[model samples]
Target: MADPKPALVLHLATGGEPLLFALTTEESGKLAGKLTQLVKAGAVETVTTKDHQEVAINFAHVAAAYLDDLTRKTTVFGMR
Candidate 1:
């Protein structure tokens, strides 16, 4: 059988650049809850973007991180 995991999209603070990766739904939930703690706990050292760009994660940078929900629905007039 094929992998049933869904993609969890990460939107970087840098110019709203989006990074896509596959993660199990369970991991996604854990990530959602641990995002702030993970940032504050000094566990993560660096973040790698999809474009092969690397970013250093510091207290100040992670302080700006937050969970957000995005949708791509079309309307009668146009895209919102």
Candidate 2:
């Protein structure tokens, strides 16, 4: 069997840049921590639960401001 792909939420900025984040099965505390760090570093706009299987992180706060980086990382993780 193949490894299960992680679910993701893609956050976008007004300029259309994306900030991809992996969805966790457990509580979002860890993810939240990482997001907080990212936000402090200006690497994300906001982090919020979109649904049971989704977490959104806006890209306005991203320092790199590149959706391609998010795409690359997501592809590597087998997330579409």
Candidate 3:
């Protein structure tokens, strides 16, 4: 079989400086495109895993960031 798809997680800093982002392996590009779109829209900063298997878009400045983090946390881990 082909290499397994890498997981992913997106973390956006909230209530603090030096913005933060946490991502896991299950939340890859294909899984988190909508968030990526938001990143592209200038709503957040996007940070993909080294292998491109995961993606984390920072949206602390946006209200939705907190919501997204909560939803995604149940699915993806904070780290690999």
6-74 per-residue lDDT for model 1 (tens digits)? 433444445465444444455456567666775567455444433445555453333244433233332
lDDT tens readout by residue for model 2, 1-80: 54332333444334364444444434344453464456456553433333554434444444332112222333533334
Q: Sorted on lDDT, highest at the top, how do the candidates line up?
A: 1, 3, 2
lDDT by residue (7-75, candidate 3, tens digit) is 333333353433333344454443465664564565545455435443334454443332124233234
Query: What order do candidates take by TM-score, descending?
Result: 1, 2, 3
TM-score of every candidate: 0.37, 0.27, 0.24
Q: What's the C-alpha lDDT at position 61 in model 3?
A: 46
| Index of the highest-lDDT prediction | 1
Global Cα RMSD, each model = 7.6, 10.8, 11.2
Off-target runs (Cα >4 Å) in candidate 2 are 1-14, 17-22, 43-80
- Scored by CA lDDT, what does every candidate get? 0.46, 0.40, 0.41
Residue 15 local lDDT, model 2: 38
The 10-residue segment with the lowest total lDDT in model 2: 65-74
